[model samples]
Target: MSRGFLPRQHGAWAMLLIPFLFGMFAAKPVWQHALLFLGWLLAYLFVYAFLQWVRTGQIRLYGRPLLLYGALLMPTGAALLWLEPGLWPLVPLFIPLFLVNCYYARRNRERSLLNDLAAVVQFSLIVFAAYELGGGSDWRLAAALFAFSVLYFTGSVFYVKTMIREKHNVKYYWVSVGYHLALLALAAICYPPGLLLPLAVLLVRAIWSPRAKLTVKQSGMLEIAYSLLITCSVLLVYAV
Candidate 1:
């Protein structure tokens, strides 16, 4: 019996995070900005921890570009915490992460950082879209929204894989689409906290796949289904 969606660690992380979100969302308006900064700093901490112990022989996620990835991501996220005016602050950090995740994937040509990194980027875009829907137009807050979305979505993927040694052979489109719509809905309902549901699905999938190869027809089906579903979901949200 193969695992379907989540790793054991994801469940544990979810347990810890649920409390944090509850508190953050419950804050006063002034605290929301501070909480956003805290989230950015937490991301920096993730990189720091990844760097400090990634080479412990038991694990080795930081190498070459990822090392540089850690270097820039810390300051980039910090600057955004201070300024919160534009996406420039995050560009340096995210571009490097995205490029390197791609580089590693290309170099290794396996289920490497590329997939999860892409997931994060895509998720960030979805969060960005939420701004337009929610009638937000601030460039700075828009960027932060995108950044946190990326961090949460991609962060979930990496954490799940590292902690649980999640393995899978899959494509990512509708899953993320479902995630985007779900997040949008939650945002509409004034429950940005609900975004975790779709993300959790990805984390779970990371840990519990059979790693089976799909036939050409099956692969085509998945791709088409993903495209159609995501398009419809996004359109429906916009229409509403």
Candidate 2:
């Protein structure tokens, strides 16, 4: 059962995820933001506790990595509150990936999906907060960030469906990721200063994920899409 399990679980998780992302993305340098940061930390702790409760209802976890996360996160929260939005976006990221590993070990696929969804949410929040801190509202940059979110979310959905719709070929995973990378890279190549966001996207993808292989057809489609995006980008550049 591939994504047959996903539909069963996505709705409940989405309700929680939406608010978390909302809070994260809405981050700015307000004096009142400290209180909100405390709230976010509380939320993060609650989620971790919930995941643990689900994993082991008995509640006895003295894991080294968990201790490590707390050590890292305490300092990180300090940095973010001190106006280090650049690094803060990534802190929430560490927790989810650890959760993802737990999910994989348990063979609970829905948990992994939630992890990816959570990742995009955090990364988008980073982009939003980072840009705002850099200057006043740049709606154009926000739009581009949204576009990147759309592409990533859509790619993630399609990749899951492709796994379900086509059978359990995990290679399609890389295909969708590669599709996303190609699009971002082309965007960077076509537009100057476009590289930053794309590079961020690429870095997140490259660093956080384990390597996976794709099939010929998957590779071919990505290549075609990359070529097409490049061609259209060039045409638009010339037209402008």
Model 1 TM-score, all chains together: 0.31
TM-scores, all models, native as reference: 0.31, 0.38
- Give per-residue CA lDDT, model 2, range 1-240, as digits (tens): 221112233323333333333333433345434434453454455445445545555344424334544665666556556765544554565566656645743554433556556544543453444344434365564555545544545454445444344334457656666766776676666445534453454434432332334564664455345334432342233223
Candidate 1 residue spans exceeding 4 A from truth:
1-90, 102-110, 113-115, 122-214
The residue pairs that clash in candidate 1, if any, are 3-208, 5-204, 5-205, 6-204, 85-140
Which residue pairs of candidate 2 clash? Answer: none
Best of the candidates, lDDT: 2
Off by over 4 Å in 2: 1-62, 84-119, 160-240
Write down the lDDT that model 1 would get: 0.41
Give the lDDT of residue 39 in candidate 1: 49
Could you tell me the C-alpha RMSD of candidate 1 in Å?
14.1
